[model samples]
Every structure is written in C-alpha cells, then in structure tokens.
Target: MAVKDAAKDEDDDNEVSAEPTPPLPTPATPPPSPTQEHIPSSPQAQTAQP
Candidate 1:
C-alpha cells in the first residue's frame, strides 16, 4: 500500500510539472503614441463661446 501511495504521489507531481503554461495574450496592434501628431484639437479650441 505504501508503494502504491508513493507511485500515485509521483504521478501527481509529474502531471503538475509537465503542464504547458498558456502563452500570454498578445495585442492585435501596437498601442497609439501618447503624443501623436494627427490627433484633432478639442471643439473648445475652435470656438470662442464661453
């Protein structure tokens, strides 16, 4: 019974060690730059209304 228990523990350890970790998800596209030149100015900038 002790031998069987030891074998079972070894098997469990092997299973835990052999698992393939899932790869981290990748972004579909690169993030936009914070200081990009093409960003439009706010509406407040174009109007004089207070």
Candidate 2:
C-alpha cells in the first residue's frame, strides 16, 4: 500500500508539471533604458503613449 501511494503521488506531480501554463508577457516587455528611446528628441522619433 505504501508503494502504491508513493506511485500515485508521483503520477499526480507529473500531471501538474505537464500542464501548459499560459505564456507570460514579461519577456515581451522591453528592458529599461537610461534614455527613454520613445522620447521625441529628434524629428523622426515619434512620441509613444503608454
């Protein structure tokens, strides 16, 4: 019975790990820059709204 219970527990863990969690947008977000790239310092740089 102990062995069976252990096997069942392992199976449950495997199923949880196998679940496909939604992809996070964290990676898509650009890293912080010392100088904001979107700032219209030049004629070409357009002002972007957050």
Quick one: best TM-score, which candidate?
A: 2
Model 1 TM-score, 2 decimals: 0.38
lDDT for model 2 comes to: 0.58
Q: What TM-score does prediction 2 earn?
A: 0.39
Tell me the deviation in Å of residue 9 in model 2. 0.3
| Pairs that clash in candidate 1 | none
lDDT of each: 0.55, 0.58
Per-prediction TM-score: 0.38, 0.39
Question: Which segments of candidate 1 are over 4 A away from where they belong?
Answer: 20-50
Q: What root-mean-square deviation over C-alphas does model 2 reach?
A: 8.7
Q: Give per-residue CA lDDT, model 2, range 1-50, as digits (tens).
A: 99999999999988776663323344435543423553435435443332
